[model samples]
Target: MILHVANPIYDSVFKYIMSDERISKTILSALLKKEVVKVEMRPHEYVNTTRDTLSMFRIDFAATVREKDAEGEGFKDRVILIELQKTWLDTETLRFRQYLGAQYSNKINIRKDSPKGFAYPMVAVYLLGHRVGDIEEPVVYVNHDVFDYNGEVVEEGKEDPFVESLTHNSIIVQIPRLKGRVNNRLEKVLSVFDQSRKDAEDKQVLNIDENKYEDDADMMYMLHRLTAAAADSEMRQDMNVEDEYYKAIEDRDTAIMNRDKELKHKDEQLQQKSEQLQQKSEQLQQKSEQLQQKSEQLQQKSEQLQQKSEQLQQKSEQLQQKSEQLQQKSEQLQQKSEQLQQKSEQLNNIVKSLYSKGMNILQIAEITGINKDEVAAILN
Candidate 1:
């Protein structure tokens, strides 16, 4: 027969184990280095409140502890808040601080002799499936410190650190770092988280030596709880729900990253297109300037042609005036020629008359002042 304990890396299983008053005291007592005599579970173990846009639903086990002395007698009862964390996530870091702050908000009356208000001592036992903060140890203890500019302890030295400072206290149990190695009772108890199922057949029992833990009843009890939890169908369903919840968160984050990447790519393409358009616009501007220069040159040539045409029109007007003056001179000469021809015709007629009156041709030519041959011809 195989002995198994449900992996405490699962919050549900961790919660189950921590909820047991006896088991939780054993674990907390080992972690706090105090002998827990009696433990009473406090009310409102889990707060489902929301803060800062985050669901403040945290699995908490508030334990009131009565420590045992060497005489096996109980001492003054102490309040310690044991928080079971399966995994530490980045978003939940702030939430974790908020949770611790919430714990500090409450005042517990511990002693009738002492003051009426005090906060509970908190011990955060993290059954981490992964490592954090480059811490190589399987178990790392963190204590709140009051330091100055230098790394010097300024708090009053007290015999008990947890009692002196309730604010600065935490214990981290990194189960993956353990790697199935057990050195102490605490490690033995935490070993259940380190165990894996025997096969992919989903068997509840772990194939480990039960004899090694037969002397340890707490380990045995834990093994029984893990086996029972594994066998439980309803519990498995609840675990499945938790798995899906975490998966959905991862899926949502991945989707956002992919969407941002796609948008960045689109922005790059748009920028390239804008640059291309700007280049084209610059080219068009250059072409337009060239066309304007050509038009200016053509306009200058047209103005030169217009000036030449005006000069030619003035020369044509001057030639027309000269041609009119020549016509007037020619008309005066024609009138003079007509008057001479009339005088000559009159003389010729007189010559003929003289000849007819028995006068000689020479006397007729002298009277007309005409040539004698011309008068003879006229007489004949």
Candidate 2:
């Protein structure tokens, strides 16, 4: 089955170099402390080639080495390739075989051009992000060699009775199955790769204890940086959401404040109108009271005028009776005419007094024994 692999973790790269080149050199150098020469580092590169119309690929990381072997012999000390795998698939074995073949081919071709026969051993290291079980050891592989009954190796196609024939050699390191079997820097690097793979599969950032893997300092640092980057991305998202939330709240508050202000303004206008209406009502009530008092006073004056009219009517009737008596006695009639003139002057004074008291023409006529039409004509 085809499997898609993800990109290598920074920790994986760091761990690979630490385990193979860095740690191996340190241990081997310490053992041969007297004859070790300078160590050199090379840059990493990725190579892709088409083999039988199918694409094949491999990555080579920086290789470091000491100048001499542990026996103080001057030798082209070390050559290594760093391989990273985000996932393991069926094609992994073939892929590694291709890498091994290419490295062997290149070395053999270079040796053929040289004056002396030289054999340089090559190491191919793979850092895997998945657990590979079913292997008895952390690093296991097949070695092709012709062995005699005494377990001695012979040269390829060279038949020697005492020597076994050597044909092919390969190594395989299963990272996940290496737990609890980590003995060297290489094993520790594999352990870190296993942990990082687990974290990636779980969809979590690596959170390893730096103190525990102090020997793999570069690996720990790389993992820490990646985890921090993820956290920072999350924090930025949260901050943006918080900012938007506050903005919405602010807008809502402003709307509420504006509505309250409008209500207050309307209330103020209503209060002013209410006060004006109350004042108008009070004025109207005062006017009504005054009109009522005026009506009462006018009614009392009308009653007094009615009483005076009855007295004046009785006096007019008496004067008519007196005139009738005078007509029967003509000599007494002239003296009665002077008496009637004095009575008419008193009646005119009473009528003037009633007119000064605000009586209407009809009321004055009724009170002063005068004809209503005659009183109206005099007033006009």
Best by lDDT: 1
List where candidate 2 sits over 4 angstroms from the true fold: 1-57, 61-87, 107-113, 116-119, 128-133, 141-149, 153-169, 179-184, 196-204, 215-380
- Model 2 Cα lDDT, one tens digit per residue, 69-130: 43556655443233332223234566566555665455432334335544343334454434
Best by TM-score: 1
Q: List lDDT for all candidates, in order.
A: 0.61, 0.46
lDDT for each residue of candidate 1 in 1-380, tens digit (9 for 90 to 100): 55544445455665676678777777777777776766665665434321112222345666666665435664676666666545534444765675566666655423233453444556766555566778877888887766668888765553253454355567877755777778876777666666443434543234556788888787677677777777777777766766666666667668657866875686566556556655655565555556555556666789876565555555555555554554555555455555665676677667756774668878887887778898865543
The alpha-carbon lDDT assigned to residue 202 of candidate 2 equals 31
In model 2, what is the error at residue 192, expressed in angstroms? 1.8
What's each prediction's TM-score? 0.60, 0.37
Off-target runs (Cα >4 Å) in candidate 1 are 45-59, 62-79, 88-90, 108-113, 146-166, 181-185, 195-212, 281-380
